[model samples]
Target: MHGRIKGEAAFRRYVARASDELRQANYTVSAVDLIVTPTRTVEEVILSTDGPKGRVDLPIAIVTDRGPGGLVEIRMYFSTWPITGEHAIRPPLLQHDPNVHEKGAVGDYQRALAAGDLAATLAAFEPQATVREPAGGEYTHTGTAELTELYTLFFSNGGGIPLEHCTVPDDGRACALEYNVTQWGRAAMPPEAGVAVYVRGASGKLIAARIYDDSNPPLHRPDPSFAGCVL
Candidate 1:
């Protein structure tokens, strides 16, 4: 995969290569959901195609930010194992440490996560809020009962999953944060990059949180039945 391309010329070249690769793979992409704000837009996309084994569908998230002049920035989030057929650590995207000082509901959520307090984390979400896990749709946790069970397992490691927030794109309705996972609970690991979109409700609490990371939690166990690569 092309790591990081700078300049319009380089970006165009990378796009050309990607187009060729996808065409050769007979891949087709379709949008699943979209969230728009004054300055930001997040799209949940699904890429499908027939592969050597059979048909496969891969889910991905794309975040875009706009500015007064024109485009500001764009980033894509998805697990590479789906394409490479292997699980490996992702390299950090940001060269330097990030300055993370969030405000509003997102700030509260971040603080709660750092504290690793189950009650506080639950309070950050609406009564019937939903959290979609990174794997896919089947892993979504909904409502208090399900969320309670999810976070209970999450905080069992004794600390919060700390993320070094890199870029936060928000315009009141929702906020998308590009971050690097620095640590999970008491254990630390190599910085792994990921992105998540947090949607806010009328009460300023979270309505939904869609995560796009493959970071293994301390309690995570691999399932042999699941195949990492899709189409």
Candidate 2:
């Protein structure tokens, strides 16, 4: 149920196994939005059926790349917290309404995040905005207070977080970015694969930023406790 699968037969078995497991668990999956480019497609989906405890909402993004022959690659981005309901207490990001797509707002957010400007970043969000850390629900940051704390720690390295954007697909409600983490502040690192979704609100501010990545931060100014924070 983890890592990459090779070969068409192995991939088929993997899909079958996943289908069987989801069906056995009584989970229902649905697509929230889809965006297709010339050579790639991104589908935002939600799995909010049944889990070990009860109904849990898990938002995911599936990215597919097209080759000359057919589909060349598929990557799914999500955390397993909703599936296991482990240390999760926050509400779902896509419970009632999906995020609205505002490219302007998304662009502002990207600038602020890339520059590591905490104030600018906060200004790009609504008053009650939330940021779900890549780790899981337990690390969700809501409101200005929590978000301030989170971003302050984030920019402690004295510079911005650099990303090598691969593909960005946007429907009307959300923009999913496929990226590779190349640097954090002044430190350079090996390319680490990751994906993040920026959800815009009616006011043209970001309501949520959901990250699905496992990149380790190279902290120049480390905090003793940030709840096992990562990119």
* Top-scoring candidate (lDDT): 1
For TM-score, the strongest prediction is 1
Q: RMSD to native for every prediction?
A: 4.0, 7.6
Model 1, span 86-136: residue lDDT tens: 445667665434665666878888888877878988998999998876655
Please list the residue runs of candidate 1 whose C-alpha ends up more than 4 Å from where it truly belongs after superposition.
32-41, 65-73, 84-86, 95-100, 220-231
In model 2, the Cα lDDT at residue 183 comes to 67
> How far out, in Å, is residue 13 in model 1?
3.1
Q: Over the stretch 15-134, how does candidate 2's per-residue lDDT look in tens digits?
A: 999888788878877876677777878876777667667777776777888988999878877655556423222212221212332278777776787799989989989999888865
TM per prediction: 0.81, 0.70
User: For model 2, how many clashes?
Assistant: 1
Say what the RMSD of model 2 is.
7.6
Question: What lDDT score is found at residue 198 in candidate 2?
Answer: 78
lDDT of 1 at 196: 80
